[model samples]
Target: MKTTLKIAGALLAGWAGLAGAQPPAGDADIRHGRYLIQTSGCNDCHTAGYMQKNGQVPEAEWLTGDAMGWQGPWGTTYAANLRLLFQQVDEQAWLARARQPMRPPMPSPSLRAMSDADLKAIYRYVRSLGVKGSPAPAYVPPGGKVATPYFDFTPKNLPPMASQR
Candidate 1:
């Protein structure tokens, strides 16, 4: 099931790259989506300058993806522009795609644990913001070249975990 969702997500993520039109949704649904997005810290990484600005970034710029890179044992991963990503995905696609694991810093486990309703709310909120900007830069595998600035996590000398007494 996991692999299936991953494959499906990959396909849908590429298949529908256009989502200017929004599905009809009630005010309550949109509100829930907005609430979920704000409270869940989605803007922390998804929106450029969000953290530096202390979450004061405008709603118009939310979920547009960021250029900042998180580099570590997994190489590098950029925050996906959810605004653009959700544009490509419909509600059903989001339900399945949301379950797939993403690279580091994505909190895939937290996303996977969310209820269907919560996921839908998140989707709705992002889509409501409308699509803007280009897709995030592609992933850079370990030992691969990276052009953008990144937060390096290459491990240095570190103490080992304490032995169980």
Candidate 2:
């Protein structure tokens, strides 16, 4: 089931890329998605900026997604730009895809466990992070080059194995 979701997510992303449209649903669920992203620390992996000491949202990039500090056996998995990625999909589709298991180091299972309503809220919130111009930030030590954010977990670069239940 997890593998299927991963493949679905990849396929959805590919389809979105080909369509070149941002079709976010203009609803309250967007707010939920935003909350999920915030509390869940989605940007830590997706957005590209020098992660602050704590796990606060990267103000510069917001939810544009980025490719930094994402080193693993997956070969630098990037957090998908939720704003652009969820533009066109419906709430159910978005939730299903968003809940897809992310590669190791990402806790997609928790997201998968979210209730439909909760997931919809999160999806809506994420969709609202309209594409912006904050280019990626340079590398700063994951600890504290700036004011500490909240939760910093930059693991030593290594291959990830499937975690046993």
Q: Top model by TM-score, which number?
A: 1
lDDT of 1 at 108: 88
lDDT of 1 by residue, 8-74 (tens): 9997776667575444677788899898888888889888999999999988888888888999999
Candidate 1's C-alpha runs over 4 A off are: 1-23, 161-165
TM-score of each: 0.80, 0.54
Model 1 lDDT vs. the true structure?
A: 0.87
Model 2 misplaced stretches (Cα beyond 4 Å): 1-31, 53-60, 133-165
Model 2 collision count: 21
Pairs that collide, model 1: none
Report lDDT (CA) for all predictions: 0.87, 0.61
- Tens digits of per-residue lDDT, candidate 2, 6-75, equal 9999988887797546554566566656667777777766665535545554555677766443443343
